[model samples]
Target: MVKKIFYNSLFLTLLSLTSIVMAQKQYPINYFSSPLHIPLYLSGTFGELRNNHLHSGVDIRTQEKEGFIVYAPANGYVSRIKVSAWGFGNALYITHPNGYVTVYGHLKAFNPAIIAYLRKIQYEKESFEQDLAIPKYKIRIKKGDTIAVTGNTGGSEGPHLHYEIRDEKTEKPINPLLFGLKVEDTLLPIIQSIKIYTEDVLHDKVLEVKKKDHLFSLKSIDTLLVPAKFSLGIATYDVISNTTSKKGIYQLELYVDTLLYYQHTLETFSFTESRYINCLINYPDFIKTGVKYQQTKILPGNKLSLYNKHINNGWIELKDNLVHKLRYNVLDVNGNCSELVFYVKKDSSMQKIPLSPLPIIDSNLLISYNKIDTFCTEEVKVKFPAEALYEDILMKYASYPAPSKYYSKFHEIHNIYTPLHKNISLSIKTDTVADSLQSKLLIVRIKDDNSIIAEGGKYENGFIKTNINNFGKFAVLIDTIAPTIKPLNFKDKTNISKLKTLEIKITDNLSGITKYKATLNDKWILMEFDGKNNLLTYTIDNKILEGSNLLKVVVEDSRQNVSELSFELIKKVP
Candidate 1:
């Protein structure tokens, strides 16, 4: 008995040593620190659940609030700064001198120098969001400088610093924890469900591997079947130590009957193929239902990637009745791992679907229907052509109510969620007028749930087309939410020389702020308002106000929430 245990231990040690020697991991670490004062208090670890690309960065908790002074992780410069409402509200990009850029997202504000510089350029260009690429020598910075204050900004669900490190040349996002951010976590990863994706060209496709007794097995009845010699794909998520929360697995090593076939370690990845995530997972099947089934095989037309090490073909060439032993390891920052063992016996099983669609629904799949004008989840989107509201609303009753925009051509594109209902109604409430010309000539179509093609066609009137297909949400965006206003350093019936700049904050929940203006005694003043934060500021140098100046401010949101404030300020000439 003792000899058997000893040999098992020796075998594991040798295997570990072999993996270390054979598997080449380029730790993308450039610098080091314990992101938090005492250590790391990560509420969200790297590769956690997110809308896209697996959580790229870890969210360092701020003790339940914002205003933590954020410093540069390494020597870098102000490479980029993004100020927006929904995601990464106010973010700072600092490019290190060492061919890498450290990113800080969801910030409150930048330091004085950065603020002044940003405002100057914003006023000069008269635009809020302008991406500037300065020479590394131009926008320089030092380590430990208070670059930004932590806050709940952008697409943040809470107040935390969303930090990341990206390779300068390849621009691949690497884990900041790799750079020596001593996040004192001792927890090993948790192994969740192991999923297998079988190839299917007809109808829908999905399969699941569940655990029973001490072993994992496939679902008894499934339609997903693969042919002999045709490879398979596996999708799995891992957890970290000190937390059993599922996270992105660093690497998934595949062996066919103990013969190494493929190794996919996320040490680095290109931004170009990021969208291949849809292809990597069983996207269409996952959309129709909830869970995901990952496949190990890289299908044709899928330019995703295969960081293969041992074999030319990452997938195994199977024979009839091929029984294979598959092993997957889940690792954390310190390389501590948890192992999951499973077997795949060649079986041609198919998935079964009931003909009846889910008849009940919770809400319409709505996206970014509030303050700002979000076109198609992109920067500039067009929600007209009124036809999206009527007969063409795709899907039964699928809905993704998350209203956010993505960067794309023509301003932006605000995507709707999948439909979960038999039908839906798209209602629009505009402030003044819908661009009837554009809205009239526009044709509306929806990307349905089951089908990859955008279903529905040009419909008359403002009705969204409806169906039993699964297209998450429906939107013929005509602004409905109002813009909100917050005043900074307010004064009433007092001499106003004390405050040089009239700073007012304007924020819109949705379509964002379309237009904003501040007037003293009914006259225009030179001031800049960052629509991202809804902040309005008028430097006293631009326009002088006389005695008992009536300060009037008007703000309009995408839904056209016009808020006007009137106050009197007395100015004493120095």
Candidate 2:
């Protein structure tokens, strides 16, 4: 009884300390206004699980249309503007006086003043993509000032404003909702299913789940009767008011009887640790079932900061035939919550299997966390550096027939489902390829849908070498074709008097475009490239003359295959 009391006291002390620390970290609520003019609705929320990182910001809905005016939420200065083909294209960063920075992404166009400044830099540098850090005094903003217009510029599927609030000092993203950015949300998070797994002496075993009307029950009730150790996970999501998009839960608390056994709140996280989301979920299950199940029990390798007050890493050990109550409390950012209750009892009817060493499939395996691991086969070799993986895993390797288009054999380094903290070096020998095609050889990754992504590699010795993070079907392919360039609105040597811009579509058949340059009358001109549409646009300005003008465009592929287009156009002042 005394030992139980001591444990309870320690747990309470940790819980109280967590609450106090959270309460002390305050923010300037009501200092910022809604970034959009329309009613606030969310397409994505902060802390949401994404492909390889947590969604660091909230995606504000813009009525499913582009060109909506986005405003400055607080008084700040434009810290930086990043323009890219993917990953938050045309994003703006502003540093405020309150030690906070606001980010606005997927913008169609900036304000006229800002646009002029950016265009000047683009022309000076002769580049379309740039990461510019502006001085604070150069561009100042006031609260509610129009900054930019929203669009689906980057990796977005639709029109929405990706907004974020980050700590200026730590550069860590904090939940924007914590700063009094209010949205209508009354719906509680819904729990769709639950999973339980056990790590017995024999090996790890997966337990089956039975679901009905959103209530999940364990199919292996007989296994729970045995006194053993187990862990749990949940498949749940949140729906904001007037939005059908499923979002991540903000907080989760697991309770044993009436005491809090474990708790995790999505308050803030570092940008570096964002990739740890893969370890936070049941990655193997997600790969097989296509459902994301957040593991309630922290893995031994997981280093995410969201978990706190964890008792025994959220793993419950059943030692006696006594019934224990389990409760799950899930909440949204708006404080709306849902509760789930269940019971577990120990039974001795289930027998425990004895432990035995399994036979090693290959003697060349290096399965240790302390040192770098290197695995190889006849056709392919992989080199994993120290700390590339969170824990030691039995690295799997296999080689099969390559696709009809590929020149080398298909190599599967491991399951694509597993996440890696760092990249692994992959090398494939190309002895089968003709010597003439060696210069055009490069590695390509084939997705499940048979789509090809060029993993640019260089030929060294007799092998094509490159760094890869995800494990999939990889093989060597040759790219002998040059990129294609065609004018979209005008033909060569034609009058473009009424046209306000020169637009060209650039495409590549094999390797993607590497570099492109546009020149007018043998002088460099700034051409904005929108990667999504494969369009290169040059707005007519003082740079163009009234008479017949020569425009030259040169595009190069990854293999240095170049294509050039030259045209003379007659322009008149409107």
Candidate 3:
């Protein structure tokens, strides 16, 4: 009785601490306005689970087209402007006086004054990509002032504006909805299915799941017979009104007989901790099948701040034969919730079931998550830094004969299902090749479908060395072919008087494009590179004279292979 009372008191204390932390970060609801003039409908929400990281901001839809005017949410200055071909292309940052910052991404064009200022710097640097830090006194903005126009730029998939609200000092992204930015979400989150794991998921793969209406059962059994130690996972999603797009839930709580066993809230998180999402879900299952099941139990090395409460890391240990009730409460940001209830009991008959024998692994193959370890053979060497893994795992290693085109044997360090938090140093020995071809040699990861992904590396002492984040089949390969450059518009010695822009497609076979330059009549001209389409375009301006002019373009690949194109055009525009 005393022990139970002590644990109850400790739980209350922890809950109090959590409440205090939440209260301290009280967000101001009326300080900011909408960045877009249209009704806010989110295709992606803050803290949504993405490929390898959490979605840092919300993606506001732009009615399936571009050129939507984006406004400043509050009175602030343009603190930062970054224009790039990928990843939040043409992003703008504004720092307000209320200790907050607003970010707009994937812009088609900035305001005229800002565009002129950006063009001056771009011309000075002779580069398309620019990242500038603006002073507070320059480019001041008022509430509802037009800052930029939305487009499908950077890594955006469609026409939308990626918006974010962040703490100015810490640079941590906070949910914009918490600051009174309204998104119409009136529907409850949908609970798809729930999975039960009886043992270590990596080694013993005894997983069972079933789906029913609001109630879940293992294999359709009325009461699940689980092992003494077990964990649970759920596959769920949320949806907003007037859109069929599925989104991420805001909060998930697991309760055991009315006691909170685990609680996960998607309020805010740091960018550094976003990669831990690999461990937060059933990674192996996700890699095998494209389904993501969020595990209720937390791994030791998973230090994500999403969890507000957990008892014994959410591992339920059944000591008696009494049936225990399990309940899950899933909620969206608008308080619409869906509940899942089930029952489980421990039975001695479950122990009688035959279990597969654990694989016999070499002692050195065992890797701990908190320590640095190295594994090497005669031809391959890999070094893993501390905290590289989320849990202890047995390192799997194998080698196979390489194909004729490859320079070395295919070294399978491990399966690609696992994820690494930190980069691992990989060194692979290669066969003797001509000195001229040494620079073209690099490591490539061979996928299951026999496709090759170039992992750039440098040749050092007959070995290609590179830092890789994923574990898979790696082999040394050579890339000698130059990038292909094809003109889409006017050809050599053709009339381009009516053409407003010159378009050319540049692509590389193995090593990706590294650099590209274009000049008109010996003067450098601006060519906007759209990497997604492998195209470069130069808008015809005063630089191109009305008579005969020469245009020269040079493109280079990562392996130093270069391709050049020259064209003569007659510009007789009326």
Alpha-carbon RMSD, each predicted model: 10.2, 5.0, 5.0
Would you list the rank order by TM-score, best first?
3, 2, 1
Candidate 1 lDDT over residue span 468-499, tens digit each: 22333333333344566666876667676777
- Better model by TM-score, 2 or 3? 3
All models: lDDT? 0.54, 0.81, 0.84
Candidate 3 residue-wise lDDT, 517-564, digit = tens = 998998788898877888898988888888899999999998999999
Worst 10 residues of 1 by lDDT: 405-414
Each model's backbone clash number: 79, 1, 0
Which candidate leads in lDDT? Answer: 3
* Between candidates 2 and 3, the lDDT winner: 3
Q: Score every model by TM-score.
A: 0.65, 0.89, 0.92
| The candidate that achieves the highest TM-score relative to the unseen native structure | 3
Residue-by-residue lDDT tens digits, candidate 2, 120-194: 898788888989999876999999899999998877788999999999999999999989998999887887766
